[model samples]
Target: MKDCEFFFESKENVEQDGRVILDEYRTHLKDKNTREDINDNELLEKCINIVFEHMKYNRVYIYGIGSSSVVAREFKLRFMRLGLDVDYLAESHSIRMNITRVNQESLVIGISVSGKTEEVIEGLREAKEKGAKTIMLSAARVYEYRSYYDELILIGGLKNLAISDKISPQVPALIVVDILYSHYLNYNNDNKKEKLQMTLEHINYELEE
Candidate 1:
């Protein structure tokens, strides 16, 4: 009961497996619901513009580890479907060895739930040194490595449900993706509709075949 107490924020809530899951769902819902409340539109717009800027001259590179890597690949694919060929760096050397090729035209997105994953942070440092615009996506409200990123996107606000049984980092990271991606379409829906449709059609075809 000591471990489960945090989930029952109010005395009115009782502890059952159903309650445990519903409470967990509420926490997730709280996080997802707050996505719009954070007023990140300005940053979202700035990110899209940075992405758009690179879409023309340079390419987008995604760097992450563990759960962040999953989000990185997903984001890369989402942008790629929009006709922007993106790079998701899965190896340590691939990011560092290629740092020489990164510049202002290049964009490196570093995703770290703790905002303190040393590998992601250090890679972003080198990328920045090479003049690449860097974006840090994390769940932390405040952290020490804030200085390394050109733009900070804090998505999952739920702070300390750190146990393995609890929901994890990738949940909110995807919500950020959903937020940024939905807005991207809204920003240019007229131009993007055909591409979106084509992608859906292709996916449907692949599934059918």
Candidate 2:
């Protein structure tokens, strides 16, 4: 048997090991300093306010590559259900091509955990030059690229685990998305709730069909 066989030697041991892994994951998720940093900086509020300000009168584009692209897609879907005109592009070529569609009445959001995704940065740069408002979500503070975006939202919860490839790179971004979705749902409680319900029902109908 291998040296690590003890973990899977029995069903009970496997369950125990699973629980331990889950516990560790929960610990990482509950990072108090990360939560406090977001709260103190009021970045979540700013993100929500930005969405609210733009969703009404402008088109929104979210750009990301690799894992960050998944979070960008999720954000687009969530905001879509809330009746916002939002879309996401994950491919480098597509992002570059889409820059032309961005204009003064546009809000462009870029996601990059490393804070140095060339494609995302370039996309945001072009969008900004076209007079679109830009927001960059990152875990690292890339001050050099500060001029490229209007808002820089730093996401920190899983710490270096994401950078070290120990966990999903999108976890921190997903947490921010969930918080933003919740605030958006509560913004115009009744109207947004109705929109959400309508979307859910439409999805369910399509699934059943």
Q: Indicate which candidate wins on lDDT.
A: 2
Q: Candidate 1 — what's its lDDT?
A: 0.75
TM-score of each: 0.79, 0.84
Query: Which window of ten consecutive residues has the lowest lDDT sum in model 1?
Result: 156-165
lDDT, candidate 2, equals 0.83
Which candidate leads the pack in TM-score? 2
| Per-residue lDDT of model 1, residues 31-72, tens digit only | 653555345789889988787777778888888787778888
For model 2, what is the error of residue 110's alpha carbon versus the real structure, in angstroms, after optimal superposition? 0.3
Q: Under the 3 Å rule for N, CA and C atoms, how many clashes does model 1 have?
A: 0
Candidate 1 root-mean-square deviation in Å: 6.5
Off by over 4 Å in 2: 1-20, 157-164, 205-209
